[model samples]
Target: MKKILVLGAGYVAQPLVNYLLKNTQFELVVADVHLEQAERVSGNRARTQAVSLDIRENEKLEQLIEQTDLAISLLPYTLHLQIAKACIKFRTPLITASYVTPEIRKLDTEAKEAGIVILKEMGLDPGIDHMSAMQVIDKIKADGGKISSFKSYCGGLAAPEANTNPWRYKFSWSPKGVLLAAQNGAKFFDKNQIVDVENDRMWEQTWPLQVDKFNLEAYPNRDSLPYISRYKLEGIETLVRCTLRFPGWVKTMAALREIGFFDSESQKSAEKLSRDKLLRQLLHIPNGTGLRQIFKERAGQFWTEEIEERFDWLGLFENTPENRHNENTSAIDFLVSLMIEKMSFAKNERDMVVLHHDFIYEKAGIRHNWLSSLIEYGRPDGTSAMARTVAYPAAIAARFILEGTINLSGVQIPVLPQIYNPVLQELTNQGIHFSDINKKI
Candidate 1:
């Protein structure tokens, strides 16, 4: 069995460590900045070793790599370039959950020269979403269909019963990354045109969608146009979109935007306040302050009443007594900490991932619609859909590398049938499957 070393001990890392510890023959070594986390996952397994170290230390990483064959990184996205550099230098294959960074992309030839596989974007959005969308596109094209427009929306949400919070959002995953994406607007293709924006411009045309009695308002999330080129839809003029939201989410998000929660720019008082302090100040804005108060105090007001209502309904406004010292903080800052506060799953409340995709295409002058939705609930073992969607695809990619299923070396994203078929099937078998229904376009 090949020896694999995994870096990081966060949510994604835990599921991965658990998966490898049980299923694979690979000798796994788990490393983390938090020794207890590494220890918790490693236990007493003979093939597993847990340790604390500054991974940026080149000499130490080199020492660990002496006995390691495959390096799996679950580190934050920014660390990918440095990790990729190390993998290339060591002639070791590395797989990460991050999107392909420009620096890492530039190393394709060097990695290929070193005979090392550097796979990226194999996690949730860039991972499963890419593979699944490609598979669907391939099927549509193969079936004599001309692609028209495509939209994919996936969100890791707290189940209704478990979602006591107003935003219906919780940080079962990374908080910083979540904030970054939410701050960044949705990008997509629409009206036979390619478009990208930070707001619910897609909700202007709401397609009523019903699945298992769950009604959702569809909107686009990121740059959906590139997928046309990436998925090889040359003959077709297509609009693509992806969204992340809860029911009636667009209006609430719009309210937030009206209140200014989407701003990534440094605030006017940021020079006097650190990021944390700025966040605290934002949270300190009272419930009834309204726009005049926001404009008077902060530079903007982008959040909505729904968010405030959610907070009030969730009892987030009440004094927990535990966090009582923070009376003057902003709701956003309080939310930041609150997310992490209950990020882990409760024993009875399940976490779920809802992934919805709509592909509009034409075949033989017939306009046809294909709608696919995937819903995966949290494991009884305390894993969230966020972790599963992110980690499983990554592990599958690693499996391909270990089993010699994907041998073309270089920096790459998983889009091929060889990469998608087995992983998708396995994921389906493991409670991740998409249901497709035909409709008139």
Candidate 2:
């Protein structure tokens, strides 16, 4: 029997673990730094073993990889390279939902020589987004269409019924990932011109958007210029990739960022500081002065009723007890902690994932405007939409690799037809599918 190792049994691992166990006969080893988490994911099921593993232990990681036919890394992107090296040494194929960073791409030749595939970006935004868009792009070209403009937006948000918080958001995946993404600058093509957005001005580029019946806003996600070649859309007049959030998110995030709340520097004295004290420090307010009063005076344009309400709702102005656990954590760490505490989904609360693509093309002298959109909701059984969408694609791809259905070796993503076609068909079978609508204008 083939052995498959799953590294990092975090929020999304449950779906991937469950899907593999249900669909394949492979013996699974679910490992994480936390024994409890690994055991929780494996569920003592037959053909599964749960083990605690600190991935930093190189020898131990190699020992595990050497025994497995394939290793699926769900670890943070920073750790992916370490995992990749181990897999290459063992001649074991590896798959991940993380983006293929330049450093990872550098492993392509080594991976090819080893005769093993290193597939990355097999998750929702990077995974399904790539597969779905490429499917449409390939179809358009085959139909003799000339692509003009392409815009894509994706987001994981609280379902309307579960949108109870003032933020209209909940953590279905990594909170730190969301915080880190806010620090990115973005670049994209607009009407044949390149537009660069600095990190500080990212929120300023947001625009309102409507997907299906829900209203949302979008801001550039990150450097999108590289995708012009990846998607084979050279010379396209416009190409933009963005992230979506409910109406007030951009304003709240911009205000917090401007207030030094997103600062990545660690504070040695943070262990003794409570939220109110930190708030006072950020706003330069004196002790005994009302936080609202000083905030209004110092915030200038950022001070708004809604922003203040969101801040107050987060308990940032409360004289709460200091968290001694903070130790040397940074301001952004505190923000992530607070969001996890305040914005996490409650039992039975559903989360939503939305991916929308807007395309303009010319075919036979007629211009066509097309939209491909997908909306998925978390199950009532407490399985999150984020987990399902992010995990299933990777899991399905892993199955194909195990079955020799995807035999190509080297660093890869799901953009190619062989990878996207079968994976997308299975995704539809799993009830995660996109709807495409087109019109002539």
Candidate 3:
């Protein structure tokens, strides 16, 4: 049997691991920094092995890549470049859920020459989002229609039944990733013009979105201008990709940003400060200041009852001894740590993944609108929706590569019909189908 080496057994790795073991004949080797975590995922399966791997050890990492027919990296995006180099050196196919950076893109010629595929962005937003959109876009083109506008939104959130928290969200994946994304400036196409939102104003600029009676908010995700060419939507007048969240999320995040909670700069004086002291310094309040007074002074008119309640629930204003701030923590890290403690999914709670795409096309002088939406929920205390939706596509792509269905050799994404169609069909068979609605406008 062919062998697949999975790097970094993280929160989202288990579903991919289980899918390969149950559905394929490939031998699976899961490697991570923590042996127990890797072993937990492996479960002593007949064709599976777990090993401790510190990716920094180049010799060991390269050796593992050399031994496997394919390498699937579940590591952080920053580490994917090194793994991609190893995969090239070993002449092994590679797949990852992370975005392809410029550095990784530079390896396309090398990977093409080696006749090995290095597929990137094979997970949730970049994965299903790209595949599902392309499926529609291609059909529209084939039907002699031209897409006039396209907008898409995706989110990982608490299921309706598990929506007890004020935030209406829980960490199904990395809390740090969610926090880091909040600080990104966004650019999207609207009315034949490029609209850019600065990082500080991202949260303040949101659109109200309604999905099947569930009211939510949408804010622009990362740069969407590049996708005009990436998806070949040259004549499209409007193109936007956004992230969905509950109604109050944007306001809460805006308040947090106003208070410098998302700042990444290091503060030397905060090294030995207590939680309360750190809060005082960060907010520019005196040490003896009351929490309410400090909030009033610092936030001015930006603070609302919802924001105040969220901060109070997170114990950000409390002098509790257990909330001891980390000595070396950056502002963003400190906020992420607090979010991890306050916003984690409970044992009995379920998470949800929502992906919705809107396509407006014109055919024979008539305008038509097509909407496709996917809503998947997780089993309580089992595989999360975020994990399943993110990992399953990668696993499906891996199987396809092994079966010689995907024979392309280069650094690529799932925008082509050959790549997206089969994966979308398989996703439907695996109970991750999107509901489509068509109408004339």
Candidate 4:
């Protein structure tokens, strides 16, 4: 039997691990720094083993890769290159849900030369989003049509029934990732012109988006220009990929940033500081100034009752003992900590995943619009929608690679039809499908 090594057993790893184990006869090894977490995911399956592994320990990581026919990395994106290098050394196929960075792309020729495939961006947004969009774009092209505009948006959120928090959001993944994304600038094409949004102005660029019954907000996500080329949309008038959130999210995040919550430069010198003191320092409030007053003075017209209530709910004004410790944490870290404590999903609470894509194209001398959307919810007290959507595509891709259905070698993504068609079909079979609404304009 073939062997597969899965690195990093995080929240999203469970679905991928279970899917492979149930569907394939391969011997699977799940590795993590916390061996218990891996073991828990393994579930004492016959062909599965869980081991303690610090990916930073190069020898141990390489040894595991050498023994496996394929390696799936669920580790942080920063460590993917190291894992890729090891996979190359061992001539093992590699799969990851992370985006392909420049460094990772540089390995393409080498990976192809080694007769091994390095597939990246096989998760939710980059994974299903790409596959779903390409399926339509290619069909449009095949029908003698030209895409004029393409816009896509996605989000992980609290299901409507579970929306009990002020933020209308919950952490289905890393809290730090959510905070860090707010600090990212974005670039995309609009009417064939390049539009760049600076980090500070990212929130300001959002507009209301109506996805079915939900009134959400959309903000550009990272650089979308590269995707124009990636999607082969050479003369498109507009191309943008955006993140979706509740209506008030942009304004709240903007206020948080203005208050210096996203600042990573400031460090805590003291061993401990009360929440009020921490807030005062971060917001630059005077010794005698109250957080409420200072917030109004700095935020001016931007301050709202909703925003103040969010802060209050987070206990930013309270001297809670839990918020007293200073592990030399930065402003971002502190904010992330508060969010993790407040916004985490509770047992039996369901999370939702929303993916919507709009394709504007001209066919047979008539303009047409195609809107494709996928909305999935988690099973209460069971597998999360975020985990399933993110992990399922990668798991399906891994199965294809192992079964010789996907025979391409080199660094790649699930863009081409051969890669996307079967994957999309299988995803549909597994209850992860997109619905398309087309209209002539």
Candidate with best TM-score: 4
lDDT of 1: 0.70
Q: What shift in Å separates residue 27 of candidate 1 from its native position after superposition?
A: 0.6
TM-scores for every predicted model: 0.84, 0.95, 0.96, 0.97
lDDT of each: 0.70, 0.89, 0.88, 0.88
Q: Which tens-of-lDDT digit does each residue in 350-382 have in candidate 2?
A: 999999999999999999998999999999788
List the candidate 4 regions with Cα displacement exceeding 4 Å.
266-273, 282-284, 322-326
Lowest summed lDDT across 10 adjacent residues in model 3 is found at: 320-329
Q: Is candidate 1 or candidate 2 better by lDDT?
A: 2
Per-structure clash totals for the candidates: 26, 0, 0, 0
RMSD to truth, every model: 4.7, 1.9, 1.9, 1.5
Which 10-residue window in model 4 sums to the lowest lDDT? Answer: 320-329
Error of 1 at 161 (Å): 2.7
Residue 189 alpha-carbon offset, candidate 4, angstroms: 0.5
User: Mind sharing the TM-score for model 1?
Assistant: 0.84
Better of 1 and 2 by TM-score: 2
Error of 4 at 160 (Å): 0.2
The local lDDT score (0 to 100) that residue 102 gets in candidate 2 is: 88
Residue 98 error, candidate 4, Å: 0.7
Which residue pairs in candidate 2 have backbone atoms (N, alpha carbon, C) closer than 3 angstroms, thus clashing? none
